[model samples]
Target: MTDPDPQPWLRLDPRMLLVHPAREVVRFLPVLVGILVAGGASGAGPWGLLGVGIPVALGLVRYLTTSYRITGGRVELRRGLVQRHLLSAAIDRVRTVDLTATLAHRVLGLATVVIGTGSVAADADEQLELDGLPREQAAALRVQLLQSGAAAADDAALPSGTPPVPVVRFAPRWLWYAPFTSGGLVAAGALIGVLSQTTELFAVRIDVTEDDLSALTGLAVLGGAVALVALVVLLAVAGYWVVNAGFSLTHDGGAWHVRRGLLTTRETSLDETRVAGVTRGEPAALRLAHGARLSAIVTGLARSGESGAVLVPPAPRDTVADAASVVLGTPAPMTAPLRAHGPEATRRRYVRALAGSAPVVLVLVGAVVAGASPALLVVAALAIGAALALAWDRARSLGHTLVEQFVVARSGSLRRRRDALATGHVIGWTFRDTWFQRRVGLVTVDATTAGGQGRITVPDVRVGDAIELADAATPGLVAPFLRLGSDA
Candidate 1:
C-alpha cells in the first residue's frame, strides 16, 4: 500500500523574507562602535563610513534577500540580491536537519535550521529563521522529510526510516542537572581564562620598591584570587547546565530527532536506521548518583571537523535503552557481564595512573626546589593519589560481553555504564601497547566503529588474549553481520 502524504510543511511568510532583523542589528552593533571609535581617533569620515556602513548594508541585504519554502516533496531556498541564487533539495536527499537558537533568538522567539547532506565539507545548507513561526512548524518539516521517503531513497541517509519519527521531549527533572554536568567544559574554559589573565598580568615587570610588593600582598590581592577561582567554577557549572537544558529525543515514523541547548538551542534529526551503535557513559561521581549519559554512533553525523560520535546528554539509565530501541529498531539487551579486573589488571591500572601523574609530580618537585611553600607539595601528592584511586576503581568495574549480534562493554566506578555495538558497526580494530606494557606482556584494545573510535584498555590482559579480541572484532569479520542493508 502507498503511504499517506507527510504532514506539516512550511511556506515562507512575506514577513519572514526579512529574516532575523534583530540578529542583523546585533551583528552590526560592534561595527558601528568600531566606526565611532575610528572616526574619533583618525578624524576621517570616509574611513568610518567604510567600516560601519558597509557591514550595515551587507546585513540589510542579507536579511532582505534570503527566503525558503518547505513543501511536501522538497525544500527550496533562495538568497543573494545582485548575484541571485536558488537551491533546492528533494526531501530524500537531505540527510539531516537541525534547528538552533541563541540567547537573542530565544528572547525573540526565533530559531535557525542547519541541513546536512553527509558531505565531508565544513558548511551545511542552512536557513536563518525569523520569529512568528510556531515550534510545531519545524517539527512538522522534519516529519515530512522523513515520511516522504527522502531518507530511504538516498544512500546518504545512513540510517533510513519509514513514516517520520516522533520527537523526543526533555524530562523536566533532567533540566536541573543539565546545566551543572554539561557546563563542566565551560568551567574549564573559565579556569583557562583566569590563568591567562594571571599570566599576562604577572608578565609585566614594573620596577617598584619592596613596599610595592607588600602592597600587592594585601587583602585585595588575596580576595581577588579567591573570587577569580570561585567565579571560574561557577561559570563552568552554569555553562554545563545551560547547554543541556531542554534536551530531548524521539523517533516517530522513520526519522530521529534530538533537541537541546539553552542559550544556543539546537535541534538535529536523522534517519532512524542509520544509527550504528548506542553508548551509555557515567563519570565516577555520577555513578554514585545513578546518573548516566546516552550517545549514538551514526554513520553521517560529524563531530569536530571529522566523522565522530555524538553524545546525547546525561540521560537516565532507562531512557538510554528506550532511545536505542527506537533509533536502532532493535531491543538493547543488558548483556555486559559485570566483572572486576584481575589483581594484575588492577595493579597495572594503578601503575598507569601513577605514570600519567608523573608530569604533575615533576612540576610540584620543581616548585618545592624553587623555595615554594610545603602546602604546594602536599596538594600535588593528594591530587595524584586521588586520580590513581579513581583510575583503579574504574578498572575494577570494567567488564565486556560478546553477544550473538552485538558486543557490550560496561565500565565506570561510581557511575556504572554500558555500551552496545552491533557487530556490523565495527569498522576497524587495533591492538596497542607502550614499551612498558609490552615488557609486562599486556596490551590495550581499541575499536573503531562507523560512528567514532572507542577504546578499552584491558590493563595487564595477556597480549595474546588482547590480540584475539582485536581480531574477532575486526571490520572484515564483524561488518557482514552488523552492516544494515541499503534499504534500511
Candidate 2:
C-alpha cells in the first residue's frame, strides 16, 4: 500500500508582497540603492524604468511562489526561489500555534502563524511559520491543528468555530505595574534608540552638541539624570498601557484564548490539554503594591523570555487566583500557606549571604578609609544589610507542598515566585544535592516538564521528606529510584 496524495495547498495572499516589503525594506536596502544609482546614471530610459520596477516585479514573483497547506496529517510550507525551502510536520507533533501581528500586519488584517514542536533548540527548525495569513483563517488553523493532537491527523475543515468564555480582562488600573515592571528604565532606553535610528536613517540632525554638556554644572547633570529617569518611567507606563490596554484571557472549545495588545493586536491560543502547570509571580515591589501575574506552563512557549504568554498581567492577587482557577480547572493554590524549612536551612542561607557580601563590604570600607568616595561606604553598608535581610526572607520563602493534583513550590526573596503545577503533567523528577545540601540532609527536587521555565524546583527540603512529597505528588513517579534506609 502507498500513502495517498496530500490536500491542495492554499496560496499565499497577494498582500503578503506588500507586508514583506514593509517589514523587510531594510534587508533589501542595497537593492534599492542599486536601482537609485541606475536611475540617476541612466535618466528616465529603459534602465531607469527597470530600476524603479524591479522591487514590485520581484515581490510579486516571490509572493506567487509561496504557499502553505494544512493536510489531514501534516502542515506544510513551501517558498523560496534559487534555493527553494519546504517544511512539513506531522500534525500530532504540533505543540503550539501562535498568531502574531505587528502594527502593519494588524492594519492589513494579516497575521503570522507559527507552529512549534516541543524542542529546546534556539533555531526551532522543527517549527513551521505561515506568514501573512488572514487573521480569521489563522485562528481556525490553530483550532484544527490542536484538536487533532499528535496521535492522529485529520482536516476538520470548518468555520472559525465557537469563541471562548472570558476568564479575565485587564482594567486601566493594572497600568500601575508598568513602571515597576522594569522601573521604566528599559522602555526609556528603547525609545531613545528608536528615535536615534529614525533620525540618522533619514539624515536629520539634532540641535545639540558636546558644548551643551560642557555648559552644564554638577547639579545640572544630576538634575538631567533624574529628569531622564522620570521620562523613562513615563514611557514604560505608556508602553504597558498600549500593549495590554484591552488584554483578556478566555476559555472555550478545549483551548485558551489570549488576546491583547493595542497597536499590534495579537490573538494567541493554547490547547487546554497542553497546559503543564501554572506559575504565580509576586515580586516584592509588585506584591507590596498589591499586584501579581499568572502564567500558564504550556508546551513550546518562550523558555527564557519575559512575558511569554502570561495568563494574567498585573492584577490583584485575588483576581489572578480566580482567573487561574477558572482557566486551568485547578484550585489555583495561590493562597497555599507555605511550610518553612527548618532553622538549619535559614542558617545556611544567612551564612551564604553574609559570606557573599564580605568582599564588597571590605572593599568599600577600605576605599572610604583610603580617601576614595566616602559615599561608597554608605552604599556598601546598605547593600550588605539588604542582602542579609533578603537571605533571611528567602529562607522563610523556601517551602513546598503537594496539594492533590498540584505541587506548590515557593522560593526567592527579592522577587518571590510560587509555582502550582499539575502532578500528572510533570515529565520527570530530579534530586539535586550539593556538598552543603548533603551535609545538611537537604535536597532540591525539581519537577521537569515540557513547558514554562522547563522545571519547577522545590528547594531546601529534608531529603527523605522530599522523596515522599515527590512520590505522593505522582505515585510511582519518584519511588522507584529511592532507597530510604540506604543511599541508592
Worst 10 residues of 1 by lDDT: 479-488
Model 1, 321-410: lDDT tens digits are 566665555654353354344556676767777878888888998999999987899978886988788787867777665554666666
Give the residue spans of candidate 1 off by over 4 A: 1-13, 17-20, 34-60, 63-78, 81-93, 102-110, 124-137, 148-241, 261-264, 305-312, 315-335, 338-344, 358-384, 410-418, 434-441, 453-488
Top candidate when judged by TM-score against the true structure:
2
Tens-digit lDDT track of model 2 for 308-341: 4578887788788898778657664666676677
On lDDT, the candidate that comes out on top is 2
Model 2, residue 137: C-alpha shift (Å) = 2.1
Cα shift from native, residue 221, model 1 (Å): 11
Candidate 2 ranges with C-alpha deviation above 4 Å: 1-5, 24-26, 30-52, 124-126, 150-162, 191-222, 300-308, 368-376, 484-488
